[model samples]
Target chain A: MVKIYIPADTTACALGADKVAAEVALQAQKRGLDVELKRNGSRGAFWLEPLLEIESGEDRFAFGPVYPGDVAGLLDAGLHESSEHPLFLGRVTDIEWLSRQDRLTFSRAGVIDPLSLDEYRREGGYEGLDKALAMTAGEIVEAVTDSGLRGRGGAAFPTGIKWRTVLNTPSDQKYVTANADEGDSGTFADRLLMEADPFQLIEGMTICALAVDATQGYIYLRSEYPKALQVLNQAIAIAEAANLLGSDICGSGRDFHLQIRVGAGAYICGEETSMLESLEGKRGLVRFKPPLPAIEGLFGEPTVVNNVLTLAAVSTVLAKGAAYYQDYGSGRSRGTLSVQLSGNIRRGGLVEIPFGASLRELVEDFGGGTASGRPVRAIQVGGPLGAYLPESQWDTPLDYEAFTDVGAMLGHGGVVVFDDNVDMLEQARFAMEFCAVESCGKCTPCRIGSVRGVELIDKIGKNDGRSANLELLEALCETMDVGSLCAMGGLTPMPVRSALKHFPGDFERGTGNGIER
Target chain B: MHSSGEAPAVIVSSAVRKFADTPGGLLPLLHEIQAGLGFIPSDSVVTIASGMGLSRAEVHGVISFYHDFRDKPGGQKTIHVCRAEACQAVGSRQLEAHVKTRLGVDYGETTVDGRFTLEPVYCLGNCACGPSVRIADDVFARVDADRFDELLGDI
Candidate 1:
């Protein structure tokens, strides 16, 4: 029997994978061949999406961005005979973008059928869960702490500390949450992981549920990620069917059930407490700290809120042993960071590499430099709230401490490359504008400060430099940094100040220092 | 004002209907409507509001709040150029300017020919391949001015 899988992800379907799958089914039926079709999640290679995988002999032959019209020809060509088909000529494993990665978090993604528990089991999916079930909750937390796994979401907080906090908290009802709301621009690893290997996230959360003694878990995903929600819902159903979820998993006395919650298209919902508020069907508002989410989170109970990558990474660390994950990265940041090499580069996709790889290597070797073949100018590591780095800093090793030393953070390992034609002044303004738009309007500094920031950037851009504007903007940033409750308001100055500092020439070019509004 | 009873029938597809039927279905419902109709039309605002037990004004507010949603119908083709930090680092702004110059329209505006609508998307998850643009649904990453023109010519 031959099997064919077409990714059901919105990105893939939009590229005509659905139509291709239908055509394959129709063609197979017409020929009366024993062919089974499964709709899976995206393979994460956006450029090669609508990627079709056909079972041949012992291996799966891949074809991609395939249209319905090409289905019959592919069938006629016999996927078995040609290992060097235009699509599979570059084998999935051989692709540099995927080949170099230490794929712990994304190990099973794009390989297993997203909805199949049997396949997931066969592919060593829940081995971590099995190990986790055997260990005591404290032991599990210790193992994670020893592993040095940090949150892959921006901030890169230690995963073990959060789990330990939840474990130590006293509560009858505790909750585990996987933050799938990856609203970061130029980032799709969360969406891909959720869609392609939902079980990894589920297994990771299930492990958290056991460790934290949480009875319920929620995968808070963004509304824009429709396909991830669909896959998660289906994966949840399959897990329930397999007794991996619901009351008494694998007939164990422990009871854990998981659900999926979609966030209203608000970027701030990525914040752990805000996600909790949204899960309760209220406005997505940021909560002040001192009682971090791990201690008293999600309706005032103990909660273990983690990013999708953090949870997914937990599975790998638990399954392969802590040393395996601990051995990968530089100081403080452990395990392979799944670098979402995106934006203005030739080979854009997910590449999981050891921490401390130079930014130059990532930008030049993996990213293949700027897409336009223009001279590379700047790069933005992390997300929108991250700092903009010029060419001089390209040699900086990509690790948490190294980035921090340079007044930047290794936020989510999403590196976006830019070319020389970009205007630093405009890019700086956009950061403020995005902050203004996505601000929860909770703090006066963030709400009004962001608006004023945008205006100041524009004024600088237009050469309306009344040196006073620069001073005022800097002062506003200080207040927002201290006064704002969340990163949304706090980090707005990163890009603005960096742009002004790096490209001072751009500001002083047009306007007199004494020029007024 | 058009009579509520005599308003155009907001015929939702089975996918949209299924989404709208779920509890707390407003967000997904809006997403489905946008996916189907390009933008949330005035008719959809009323129908979705009624179906979800939300006020028309509330529905409209939600639709208008997000940058992804648009009130006016988009052109036949939607050109989404990534204007995120990464793309901007690679001179995507210049590419954007060139595109605007060629298309004779600013960002978020449709061409007079109804063939293209240019939008400035923050990112399309193509950072390693910056200066990426999605024409309709096809993402063209690492695109230069020449490649962009070639792509435009094809469409």
Candidate 2:
């Protein structure tokens, strides 16, 4: 009997992988061939989604972009000489997209069954937790600090420093929280990690619990991710049942239990403090600083609030020595960053590479240019809050400091490509409009300035008062940048300013790109 | 305006007990109420508010704060098209226009017969396969005009 694999990832399901998987089973049954079906998570190579793998004759053959109708052909070819067919992508590892890059956190993502504990253990999972059990809490935090692992969340705060804060804070009750509220428009790495290898996140949280001495933890996930919600619930139950998450984890006398809390569809909840408010069943509002989330968070107790990627990376940093993880990237950024290549690009998927990789290499070479084959014009690296870069800046390395120097950000590492025909003015307007819509309304600047921004940008788009409106827009942007409490308002000006700087052609009269206003 | 309808207190009792032991149980209680009854009834707001020892205004604030929690019953099917940067980087604007024309409705508005409701979502976390649409819980990707029409034809 052959063991066949199909992706059960959300993107795969969106691509009709469910129907294709069903067809594969049906076709195989008709052919009277015995086979065991295993649904695996996405390998983050979304371009080849619905990618099916078959183990045959000492090799696992891969085929992709498969549909329901193509399942019959695949069954015939897959059962016999699977690797020789046209759809054959050779070994999935040999694909240049996966091979040319480094993968640290996402190594076992698409390769293992998401719900299977045995498979997770086989892939060297939970070894970090085991290692943490033997070492002192201070030793675990030292390992993370020495490994140069910062928060993969937007802030890039040192993960070890946060655990150290919780470790040092004196409290009867403490908490460790994972910010899975991935509300950014162009980003989905957090969602992919949760949906693929959920246990990795669980294990990472457990290690945090052991280091911080916080027995209770929570994962604040967004409401839109139904698939992720289901997968996480199942994985949590499985982990708890296996004693990987229960009262006595791995017989280490450490008790780390986790719960998944859903966020109401508020983008601002992605902000750490706002997420805390939402978790407590209130209207999501931005909390004031000075009494930061590290010192007084989640019911006024010490909490370790890190992003999904940050926590996931902690597991690997502990499993492999800090030096092993630190050797991959240059500068402050260590280890591989999972870059999401999406929108308008031909080869759109997850590309995990060292931090120093060039943007041109990602957009032109790996992405294979725009899907429409049009000449590329603009690129937005990072989430929606990131600035739009022109072709001239494509050579900038993808490090945080490098992007900051360029007046851009590598937020969540989602790189969205735009072609020559794109309207910079229209894209700029959407940024303000998005901020206006998603604002928590706690701060007046984000609440009021964002609405004013849309109105001013609208006048510019309509070519009604070009010079005057542009002046007002710039002033409004300045106010928002300096006055806004959180990034929602603070960074809304990034796109608006970048568009005016780089693509001034679209802001003129009779040159509007979108349907006028 | 929401229609005044009677909701059994037993249902609210069960919903409250389901998450009563957990701290900050209002959100889960509301989710349970919505999931079980489709929409949170206007009268049931008082029931839920009292069940959680929260004021009616507080409950209403939470229910309206999030986009997903609807006060009234919606159409049978929902078509949520991505309007985020990634989808717009492609041509989802055109898809939005097509759906509006085909369905004869704008975003947040339902069809005349109430068969379908059209809405705009920022991102469905499926940015890699852009121009994505989710009809109910099932998400469809690479959804061009032809594919959308074919999907609607099946419906």
- Residues A1-517, model 2: lDDT tens digits: 9788898999999999999888988998899988899998998889999898877766666887787888888766655433566777877778888888788888888889999988898989988988999999999999999998888878788788888988999998889999998877768888889989999999999999989889899999987898999999999999999999979888888888899898767889899998998888888888988687778999898999999999999899999989999998868888888899999899898888988989999998899999999998999987889999998899999888999999999888989999887888889889989998999998888999989888887787777878899998989889999998998999999988999899887888455543332
Docking class of 1: acceptable
Can you tell me which runs of candidate 2 are displaced by over 4 Å? A78-82, A511-517, B1-9
Q: Which structure among the candidates has the greatest lDDT?
A: 2
Model 2, residue B95: what's the lDDT? 89
Chain B TM (all candidates): 0.85, 0.88
Instruction: Point out where model 1 deviates above 4 Å.
Output: A1-6, A19-40, A50-54, A61-78, A81-90, A508-517, B1-155
lDDT of 1 by residue, B77-111 (tens): 87877766767666677798899999999887989
Docking class of 2: medium
Looking at model 2, the pairs that clash are none
